[model samples]
Target chain A: MSKNQTVEQRYLPEIQRKEIDELKTTVKGASQKIIADNIARMKKADSHRPDTMKYFDDIANLFGRRQQEIEAEKQKGKKIIGYLCLFAPTELISAADAIPVRVNSGWYDTSKLGDRVVPVEVCPVIRSTIGAKMIELSPFLEQSDALISVLTCDGMTKLSEILSDQKTIWGMNVPRVKDSTQSLRFWSAEIKHMKTQIETFTGNKITRNSLKEAITTSHRATKAFRRLQELRKGNPVIMGQDAMLVNQAYSWDDKKRWTEKTEALCNELEKRVQQKDWVCSPDTPRVMLTGTPMFWPDSWKLPALVEEGNPKGIIVADEQCSGERILNDPIGVDEWSMDDMLNAISERYLMASTCPCFTSKDGNEDRINWLLNKVKEWNIQGVIYYVLRGCMLYAMEYNRVKKALDKINVPVYYLDTEYTREDVGQLKTRVEAFMELLNARIDF
Target chain B: MSTAKEFWRWHEYRHTMPNIAPVSDDIITAGVDVGSVGSKAAVMVNGQAYSWGITRTGSNSPESAKKALDLALKDTALSTRDLRYIVGTGYGRVNVPMANKAITEIACHARGANYIWGSSVRTVLDVGGQDIKAIKIDATGRVVSFLMNDKCAAGTGRGMEVFADLLQVPIEEIGAMSLKVEAEPEPVSCTCVAFAKTEAIGLLRKGWSKEKVLAAYTRAMAVRMANLINRVGLEPALVITGGQSKNVGIVSRIETLLGVKCLPTPNWRDGGLDPMVAGAFGAALLAKALYEKTQQI
Candidate 1:
């Protein structure tokens, strides 16, 4: 491959190409450098300050615009209803032409907000979510045509009641199914009920034929995304972080434009893969990002983990609201028949559906095992578990996860952050040391 | 010899000279606090606080306590032999071997608050370096119901420290800077300190004045603190203590939010009298009562 040849000229896996394209077009006019700089400044400032206040206004404005856009789209004859939980009938709702937004309370400060609705001692996430509601930060409360909340944790269970009091809210009692058969039954009922509720909310009857068609389209999109992940795994440099950003944007933004951009980017990446041409840097070490994404300014530590530590630093996977957990393992479709396809999608979704907020003593173990398997398969050197300061659920389970990971001899770096950049100096030292340990192990 | 050298030599001689110790047991008692940020010890001998000392809580708190205790004993010219009993409090209370018993800071704080500001106080808000707690007290300064901020450092002194580091100012300066604002800036929305940074930057880009933003952040935290205060139910004459008590902005904001005036005692500078020492003082008082009862018997 010649130096003049563009990344698009190289042959790349179709899925990898699409993900890269998606990342490129996610944020309009905002360069990665600018975002990185802003995040750096946020990390450097004291956790409480005028600087943090400014950041909040900026994020709130962005959310405000997005909410209005969604509302306008609904007014233009688009059927859209927002769902709260990750498993609140996403495929079914989307099939009915509704948009499901994951309700994350991690975005706002809870001090005042928690006071209005919850006790100070409750989980910080709950307090913050209530805080968001108290301050009217969540556009969903006012703009959402309808809201769906699943009982996953004590926090969510309580949230259901709070949300149901609002107009156009639906509460689904998601049964905890331990057995495979029971799981399938529960999911099937959920999908059917969700489809009906969505249809009722929109006042448009969804035909079986239309439902099947929508399911197929969603299935294709998910497959393409997963295939991209596989390609990136096979040849790491072919799809970089920017590509991943674009892919997430594709999922979160205007579907039509995102689809067009993603298709183009995928074609470009495929060309790069064909020529076996990519940016090759010294491989430092590989690690998986576990736990939640630092919500304040998004964890500034990721770049520090990669750049300062000089590690291969593949964010192999995450159990966070912001990463692979948000878009991994799409609904599967069997080619045999449409019924088989629907069943396959539902089954896959059920098996793969896990949230960090899920409450069970064993939930942490399940998450650890899942990530450990991925690390082994991907040949990752270590695991970095970055948790937010006030997240009680994750904080309680950290020692358990650390003990489990220790059994596998995978060094884990447990970083507790308030999601502020001021702690960057401390964070950098920790990440550097963690990387050094990984390197030392390899050398030994 | 030069006058400065002669003065230093005289000081050294004075340090070596032994003083005549007071020949009284005086029911001397001491309290030790093993806090995350630091440790403190207070000695009350014969119904009077004779000496108090503070030091950093190093890796081993017992050693820190021994050092703090030694310093207090030296100041009062007393010895461990003269002390009747010792009480321990704070996170590392269990680690204090010499303590006769460990008391929860909640109980100790209520007692201390009552001692400083008569028994009429109904609510006590103690904001420490690493945690924040709210306690409801009865007419006698006993804890009725209490609420704690949990393990997160947000909305505590640690949160203020993070802000101080970001703004390139001392933590003490934050409260003063906050007071200069005419209007409150937008509130940071994220619960995690990490995400709040991003929210902070977004605010910066929108051209918000620094003082306004700082004021808003203080108000937001005050709101969080107020939540805890409301949980135990607000009462007249609320008292705020702890290392964060120095932040007038936070104290004022909290007072406004709760619609109450917060009172600080004369001993506010002594790290709110080391809750552990307060506990020890209460125990000594109890011992005095017990002694009186045995005399009657």
Candidate 2:
């Protein structure tokens, strides 16, 4: 088998392996329904698809197995509530003993629903968001006890108000505090307010001790994760593409298992880092990520192209929402002042949770400049901006950013991804060309 | 009556006393714009701002328009008979019977914005009493694209008026009140103007200070106005013309958001030059060119 094929085989889960084996035989004779049914069954059995009905059944099974533990907790009489944010500090919320859910809208048919509220000329993100609201397609919308809406974008603000009126809405006004001292104070107050809101919503008071405990646990996990990523940077022990997938799944899967597996992975990664056993492909070109990640499962191909071409060179320095914003934030509960701790957390969340839809041009420019600075620091050869198709805000602003980066002499490539699976090959070709261009520049 | 005639006779005597120059016909083309909030008339006699008239659009827009036109004509001592073409522009432009042609307020405002300021302006943001427009312009004062926020009164002069009434202060004093505020008040978060008024009332009942409330209102207005500016990318020398230009509070907040200073016209008062009239002036200039071309054809 080819190197890429071997890597793919090595990474495939047991269920995916079974499906591949079945697909080889099914392609010769099975009807479309049979094939689909088989795929669906496998997906149902998989614990990774947390939102699937089968995943819920698995949770029920776990509940059944842990009935004594659950009953004892129930007897303790703690109120259970779900909180949603663009990127909520899961560690903080978990510390508060409240379930924190990341609210992301699905990519369904939005043309009809979007037309009802948003103007036709507005960007597609706004349209899709409006469409999601009109059709109520958000997985967490119905289940969420309270929603925390950050002022990340104009569209998000509008959607938050609309959703909040339907349910309990907590407005998180994370300010753009630039000074480190001021930022810490601001983040601390925000966290305190969040704690209060959590208490109000769940009617379960979060004591100082619990908050600190939660913060410590989350801080440890984040530090470990960061260390693992840093290790990858030194030696191509882990493919950058695999790192991205693991990060994406980090928030979506069962936290206990994810943490355990990640710890194991980190241990393995530490050994590799010590041995200096990093993958190296001469053809691979290092590229930094910019812009929003389109909701395609195989959009991972953009980073995969770099790995498949050259194993160790590609590193993602920035991401629109997923990469840094979701992964980098840690609760600042160790500080003496709870307010200061909250402020620090809030500021990081504010700076990190920047969506393209926000009205601050300077903020957006600053983010781009920071990313470029990191690229230079890491010796990255090129930058790739993955723009979502129909996202108007980014589409409109892309040229402006390009002009700004051009002055700095950084080569930038833009790829538009439709969150559909069919565009994988087209995405692969574009990414390949982008990687090649970066490599050519390095030679010169 | 005797004193009035004596004064006129003295003015005539003084005019005759000097080595006076001969009178010229000086055929001038003029444009009149009667808008929802104000009326303005401009006379370009021999390609110059010979004279202009402006007044608040009151109960009778057409009469105010006629008064503005008459004032411009009187300043030059020229009658309607001396004009080759008369054009009207604005929301109330259709009501001006003396106008040979009428144009929309948008085209007129863009022309006016470009005329008063040199045309390096890629975008024009005008906040009138009833409407607000973000216009993109070419080097020659022609509109490339434009966006307006007229569906609601939250970002317009009317919203300010409502807040002024709620505060029991004159609408003109809002700018000064906002300046005195050391701390910004809680933000008015409601989208609807009417709902915001209720929210403001609740705040008052809660004993929040008035200046703080006004400051909050200013911030909210700034946020709404900045949305338009953000839609059109920021270019330097941004000229903010209209009644809202007078509001120091709104202007300061806008500058803070855009990180650019707003340039107001020298004659920001007197409704400045009506954009509708400016557009009509442009149209007349175009017509003159067309007429000259047709004569050649």
Listing candidates in order, what is each one's chain A TM-score?
0.72, 0.68
Candidate number with greatest DockQ: 1
lDDT on C-alpha atoms for all candidate structures: 0.58, 0.57
Measured with C-alpha atoms, the lDDT of residue B104 in candidate 2 is 51
Q: Write the per-residue lDDT of candidate 2 for residues A191-274, one digit (tens) a residue.
A: 677777787767766666766666666666677567665665443555554455456544444455555666777776666567
Q: lDDT (0-100) at residue A95 of candidate 2? A: 63
The window of 10 residues in a row where model 1 chain A has the poorest summed lDDT is A6-15
Q: Please write out the lDDT profile of model 1 over residues A1-444, one tens digit for every residue.
A: 789544341211123446434532442123234444544443343232222223222333335455687778778877656555666656566666676555555443333345456555555556655555444455554556677777666766776666554435677666555335776787767766766788887776666665666665555665555655555554443323333344444333554444554555556556657766543432546666676543322333464444333333544444554556545666665563646655765676556755555444433345666777777776666777766655566677777777777788776766666523455533543455456446545641
TM-score of every model versus the real structure: 0.50, 0.45
Interface RMSD of each candidate, angstroms, one decimal? 17.9, 21.1
Question: Quick one: best TM-score, which candidate?
Answer: 1
